[model samples]
Target: MNLNLRHAVISNVSGNNQGQLQDTIVDAIQSGEEKMLPGLGVLFEVIWQNADDQDKQEMLATLEQGLKK
Candidate 1:
């Protein structure tokens, strides 16, 4: 079977409003389930791809700071 998880994740969240998207992210993180990682990664990929250079740099800096803790 051929499966495209990233595509599936994006499609599942398509058309969601900002509040809905935030709820999805919050729920996934709060659940602490390993299975949610792939969905988060896919969402991150979408954000990274759409972010500008400054936003990407800020995101990287924030990620670095988080990793240090």
Candidate 2:
């Protein structure tokens, strides 16, 4: 079977409002389930691909800050 998880994940969340997207992210993080990691990673990949340079920099800064602790 051929599976494209990134495409599937993005499709699953397509058309979601900001609040709904936020809820999905928050729920996934709060659940702390290993399975959710892939979903989060797919979401991040989407974000990374579309983010502008400033946004990418901000994300990198946030990631660095997160790793510092």
Candidate 3:
């Protein structure tokens, strides 16, 4: 999706707390809930977009690792 939409989803998931968003996203991922994937993708896009170079690299690396499992 577009960046704006991605940010909006992240903002919604964040619900006024940046820290909680990460945990929520991770929980969704670990839970293996197919319904949550789209929303998670939006959040991931937002995180990928806003993350610094090193963070983006690490995030992508982690995602790649997850997909291998």
Candidate 4:
């Protein structure tokens, strides 16, 4: 997808209702929806991009630990 389209989807996910966003992402992963995975990655990128340094560090640490599972 183009950068603009990815950014738009990330914005939409960020603005969505909290629980719904989490459910949508988790469901997408669980169902192996290839297209949806990019959206989720964009959401994570957006969060990482916007987060304060300390928060970003914490998030990255959490992400790394999750990946080990």
> lDDT tens digits, residues 5-63, model 4?
78778667666788988897788889896777777778777787889999988987998
| Steric clashes per prediction | 0, 0, 0, 0
User: In model 2, what are the clashing residue pairs, if there are any?
Assistant: none
Per-residue lDDT for 1-69 in model 1, tens only?
125997799899999999999999999999999999889988998999999999999999999999999
lDDT of 2 by residue, 1-69 (tens): 125887788899999999999999999999999989999998898899999999999999999999999
TM-score of each: 0.93, 0.90, 0.58, 0.71
Give candidate 3's TM-score.
Answer: 0.58
Better of 2 and 3 by lDDT: 2
User: All candidates: CA RMSD in angstroms?
Assistant: 2.0, 2.1, 3.2, 2.3
Q: What's the lDDT of the predicted structure labeled candidate 4?
A: 0.80
> For residues 1-69, what per-residue lDDT tens digits would candidate 3 score against the true structure?
567866767667655575687688778889998877888778666667889999988987998999999
Give the candidates in order of lDDT, highest first: 1, 2, 4, 3
Off by over 4 Å in 1: 1-3
Error of 2 at 65 (Å): 0.8
Candidate order, TM-score descending: 1, 2, 4, 3
Clashes of 1: 0
Model 4 residue 68 lDDT score: 100
TM-score of 1: 0.93
lDDT scores of the candidates, listed in order: 0.93, 0.91, 0.77, 0.80
